[model samples]
Target: MDYLAATAEKKYLMYISQNYSYAILRPLQQEILAHGGEVKWFLEGDEVNPDFLHQEEQRLMSLNDVKEWQPDIVYLPGNIVPNFIPGKKVKVFHGFNSGKRVNNGLDNHFKIRDCFDLYCTQGPSTTTTFTELAQKHGYFQVKETGWPTLDPYFSEVENNPYEDKQDPRKTLLICSTFSRRISLAPKLYEQIKAFSEQGKWRILMQFHPKMPSELVAQYKALQNENLTFVETDNVLPLLKAADVMLCDTSSILLMFILQRKPVVTFCNQNPDEHLVDITDADKIEQAIDYALTEPDELMAKIEHFCQQLHPYQDGLSSQRVLAASNELLLSNPALKPKPRNFIRNLKMRKKLNYWRW
Candidate 1:
């Protein structure tokens, strides 16, 4: 029996449907290219602009293209994938679960949609949970490969990306989750603008791609000498450059905190010791000021938090993810039968406009 060894002839599909997927899966693309493996992208939804595809990158234009070009495995950074896609589905995950829950209080992050054959988890925080889920589900395997999006974050950026920002003062990255109910972007706009005008810190603000355009515009208009607004598909650059972060509730905050830096969040729904959480918009300034000081207790807690999250900083997570994928193929693990969710599959087919068997 062939073990389906990973070779130069191996073909992989990068299944992405969000703006951030470009950054999350691109490092793995580079690794695939380096190993002489074939990689192609399929941007699933309108939320992902086709123009964002680099000139050198190839994208499958239609469902027919995806169906005909049988790939050995599919790597997905987002939550869902069409069941019709012909490949072993793997979920690399989009972000850490920083306490955002569904209506039933279930973790959206850990929700088993029964779509993936493997999960390349980020660290111990997720690994143990995903492992238990894997045992329960019996149809998917879990591997702690870290996150590929952050590979470049560790190895590529120079020691001083801040100097390039031209700001000696502490840098602040302001971001928020897209939920209207919890987002502090709109409420804290004046405070952020005033802080920027004060010139005590350089402000770098970015929002989720799904963030309402009008609200995003409000912050965009406030850009001045001390503050800059960016909307790149990748946030690692901003993450690397930021000295601290101000936000309400978003996985991006967890991303920044991975550096063991302090984060000031406004009315975080799941406020923990890991964050400098404040209840009022007016309190953001004082909260940020306290964060900038890097209180020893907060710093120490952040250090512990970092270990549970992504502990890898060697910039080789992409390599690990690929290797784990190959291991999965080698094992061809026997799995229990999955439920026939015809309704879900139908929705997926309609979304992609592909119904033909």
Candidate 2:
């Protein structure tokens, strides 16, 4: 029963945790549809916006509907893998390696778990890491398909959707991860404020959707003539329009790096020598100046980094992910690997409410 022979019968269920994740999963959903597969979508969280879902042309579903759909495969943009689900769980991952604090063999995200049936890695770096982990653990399939979220970046859109909407000055897009110790919002608010009010550069700030509401409000209060607070989950257009980016340990920077632009990071835990890292808030302005300068060496480094992280910039990653997933679904049940480290996995599953066994 090859996947190609059963293409029309294949059913895909995408489990999304946040509205922003739809950006990453939607490409793959379209790929599935193009291949004649039935696609069902489920959004998990009380914050799920029905209007946003409708705008994306996706239908809402109850948890019960998931059980009824009984998809052949379930694609997860985030890490959590539900053991209670009927389909084989696949991890498409949330973002590329953007220097987050991940435990190499355990918490740093390279840790092998029995939850996922297959892992679609972004590039050589991740593929090699997961391949070694799979051989060591002997419980999962690994595919080196690039991330689907990057498909739009390589598309021929002529101009950025936000290009005309941005302020006349060069735009400096700032984003931060939710981690308190590494986040730049609390530490550099005044500096950001100074930059925004100076009116030399247009400032657009995008916080992680999970950032504390209070912190979001605090930043919003700082908005002024040249500074705009971007509250939407759709940051792709903003990324396209940005001249330079300032971020701290957020993987979205990896997305920006694809554009071959400069990124100034503040105290990134997993620091890359290529990125301009500023340890002090007082020095952020200097870093931004350096980034906006667009030094040739820095541009080369960013290009190399993007190639290592995800080589194919042809905008077909979604199709690759679908092909790998279909291969897994067509395989025999007995051949499918089971989750290893039973006791540990059981504890994790129970803690995450993924399963109760």
What C-alpha lDDT values do all the predictions have?
A: 0.85, 0.79
User: Which runs in model 2 stand beyond 4 Å of their true positions?
Assistant: 1-6, 55-60, 103-107, 158-161, 165-168, 333-336, 340-357
Taking every candidate in turn, the Cα RMSD to the unseen true structure, in Å, is: 2.1, 3.0
What TM-score fits each model? Answer: 0.95, 0.90
lDDT of 1 by residue, 1-357 (tens): 222236368889998888788889989999888887899999887888888888999999888898899888899988778788888888998998877766686778889988888999899999999999999889889999899988987765765444454546888899988988888876887788799889898888889888999988888888888888888887887888888999888889988898788999998988989889999777788888899999899999999888989999899999889888877776777887666678999999888888888
Q: Kindly report the root-mean-square deviation of model 2 from the true structure over all alpha carbons.
A: 3.0
Candidate 1 segments exceeding 4 Å error: 1-5, 158-165
Assess candidate 1 and give its TM-score to the true structure. Answer: 0.95
Summarize candidate 2's per-residue lDDT along 1-357 as a digit string, tens digits: 445435576878888777787778878877777778887777776665655664546553655567767788888877765566678788988887664655553445675557788899999878998998877766688999998887987875566555655356788899998888889888888898888778888888899988988989999998887788887767788898789999998988888888888999999877786689899889998889988889998888888887888899899988888878878777633444675556765664565455323
Give candidate 1's error at residue 102 in angstroms: 2.6
